[model samples]
Target: MSSLPITLSAMDTEVRVSLCPSCDRSISCTTTVFPAAEDFQPPQDHSSEAHGTDDASPLSRARRAKHQACAIKSEIARLKSLTKELKAHHRSLVELSKQQLALVAPVQQLPVELLHEIFLHACADEEIMLRTIPYTILSAMSFSRVCRTWRNIALNDSRLWTFSTIIDLSALASAYSRPRGSWIGWDEVSTFKRLVSLYLSRSGCRPLGSLNISASYNEPALKAAVDEEPKLLPPSIFKHFHRFRDISLTNSVIKWAELRVRASQESLVKSVKIVGHNEPDMSTVLFSGAAHLTSWSQYVDDFVPVNLPLSQLTRIVTGWISYIPAFTALTQCRALKRLELSLYREFTMEEDLCEPEILELPHLVSFRLCVDNPCILDDILDILDTPCLKKLKLSWAPYSGVDARLTDDFSDWEWPKDEFSRFMDETKCKLESFTLEDLCIPPGVEVELRKQLPQSTRIVVEENSGWSDEEDLDLDDLMSEISKSDSESA
Candidate 1:
């Protein structure tokens, strides 16, 4: 190992060509020879003799030494000067490479349209960000700070600015309830309105994606909470109602009157979701005439508002709608293809009471009705008919939302199977799917019911699992325990 390193070290150094004296072998090797080695001698110092200072005084000797030192110092200074220039040259070469490479960067070559798409994708969670962050432009503003080009592109691309705003309930309520005469209160109101204006202007007349407004505080739990909702966006914002495509309002997110204002606009609204306790008056239509509406969700409890273009709607979802309102709104949906309803179903003895002129949803492919009362099924099936219905899902729940165990002696809870069979036969609709969830059904009846349906129909019966089993105790064993305990006590 020692000789191997020495051979490699010599080969790497400058080489020489020579003939070996002993064996006449050609040798090519470089030798490291010092000036003080056997073959070399340095010249003797003769500076003192030439200067005639061999017998000089102590001061003269010291002066000669100082002169020698000065010459050595000058040599070092000259070498350092060369080093500084070399360092600067190396730095310039490194920077030059960086500059040349940047000219061919992929990001630099990306077209503006492509770059705009990247920015939109970067803020894909626009709705989530709005829900969590107070500022609407924070995502845009953050991206803009990246570079001047991104700033220009993000600001000009109206699609990048289509966003949702989530305002806290308390702050929203106070913005309206407080007097604007006070500077502090006025500042808040103006600040909120300005935020809305900024969004509208940046969107550049593009179609607004969605407006999701929610209350910050729990209005039901607060003490002396204001009933008024802060119109987060000013009235001027609504002037561009044609831009709105999706809107969701919750918990008095906006005053009921604001909804009416939105209803009056000839907006190109396609989907709407409303969830609140205070129902708008039944007379006031949701969207006075929404021609473009195709999907709607109505989750209010009290009263159903009218304004929707029900005939143009294809999908409808409602929450706890009673018999009258359900019939009223559903009957108007001439184009309804999918219907989901949760109802406070209370049937009357006067089954003849008008049930909205037999809702004929010829286009309905899926129909799901949730009723707590068992009798409500008869009411619904009697008047409503969907000829093209491919899926029918029915959920039978109790008014308390829970039911006790099914027992042998319980009252007859079997829904009139014959009535359902007759209804399907009359509609002339061949169902492809059917689901019965959380209901009490007699044993073996599921198989019998399946036999009656069309061969193409897929049926599922989900029994009330919580209450299906009955614990039968033997009377002999129970009596023995009772008698034994009684005798011991006596």
Candidate 2:
């Protein structure tokens, strides 16, 4: 609180004094002037004269200054480089985002049902390659290239590969499962494993309709599937073998012997046609599942085989006719309506001595005789003695340069006209149908033969006008034309 002394010298000195201690020069200020106190110490004065001009301190200061300058410059350069990198990174990110958006936009427009139809078409035709479908659709290419949604759809469609319609077994084995090039050696295990995996995957998939495992050497896998789980072989697979309807194979898959054991269990199997080396020793239980069987054609290699009791058989074609001594053995088949002789060799010198007894099956409605040579008329009349016989089909080729009288080696044995008429009358007009093919009849005899078949709807008689002694005639075209004409007439 005591009044302090205010001097003019202090004011003037303070006004002149500098506040900046680090700077080289003093700054001007407008304020009340006060003289600096003598006791108050001032910053130390550093002048060029205080230090010598030739002192090493100057060089050291320059070195320090250069180091500081370089540090500052380096920091600035780093900042610029970082800025350029950041700009480049931002531009790339923007471009990538645009491309992603472009790819995603097109896929959203496709309908789910359209994709389903493509899968269906692929199942219908096995030959169609998956890539042929549109990119927007679910194809192998689209699934790989496009987004995840399409890939899921394509991979899920199991029917895509199930319809392996390949006819050639070797080609199919090499295509999907086996190695590309020729496989040599015992290292085929890999191929087998791959095939099993492929088939297993397909079997698990739904809607697989038809399958043909009839190709060669695949019988093991096929028979195993049928034997182990007959249900796996859907009815549709059997229905696909339209051309092979008349044929059956029960033995080759495993052995007709083994098949007889599994026959009752195979409810899916309608009919099976097979040729056995020996007569089947199995009981009729093998035929239990084949309740739907209407026809059976069996060829046994044994001299005499056991007769099959076909309950529902409407037609029976056998190769043992020549082996049977007489027709008495064939009458055992109660359901026999049609009989086809597989080894019916026309009257030969070796066989003529042991002529088989004429088979007169009372229930026989149709008879089919396949002959390598012309058969005698009396042999046919003996078979036609069955009153139920309505149709007769003969498969034979007429001999070249054979007269209508049948005097040549291929001539059909001729009986008197009265005897032939008597045999026809004895049949009681039961023979309503007759079929003859690949033969030449004399011009006048053709008309007479037609008159003999009074009730026949099928008449196939061809006059061999081209038969000559020098060159053998190609009867293929003529036979084909005759068949066509007969078929049209029928």
Q: What are the per-residue Cα lDDT tens digits for candidate 2 across 48-104?
A: 475655456555656755655565566467446645654565587679989989987
Report the lDDT tens digits of candidate 1 across residue range 1-490. 0111112234235433222222333323443311123322233455666576554455565675565556556645643654465456558767888997787476767899899878888765564322233554467767767667778888878877776655455555454556867533546656666766776788786677776654534554222333343344455555665567887766454454455364445667788887766544334244657678888886766557576677898998887767777776777888999899887657652663643457788899999988766667776777767888889988765533455432222355566677688778889888887777765655346555666778667766554522355432222333456679889999
Worst 10 residues of 1 by lDDT: 1-10
After TM-score superposition, what is the CA distance of residue 486 in candidate 2 from its true location, in Å? 25
lDDT of 2: 0.45
Model 1, residue 240: displacement in angstroms? 5.4
TM-score of each: 0.65, 0.43
Error of 2 at 17 (Å): 66
Candidate whose TM-score is highest: 1
**Structure candidate 2, residue pairs in collision:** 10-34, 10-35, 11-33, 11-34, 11-35, 248-273, 251-256
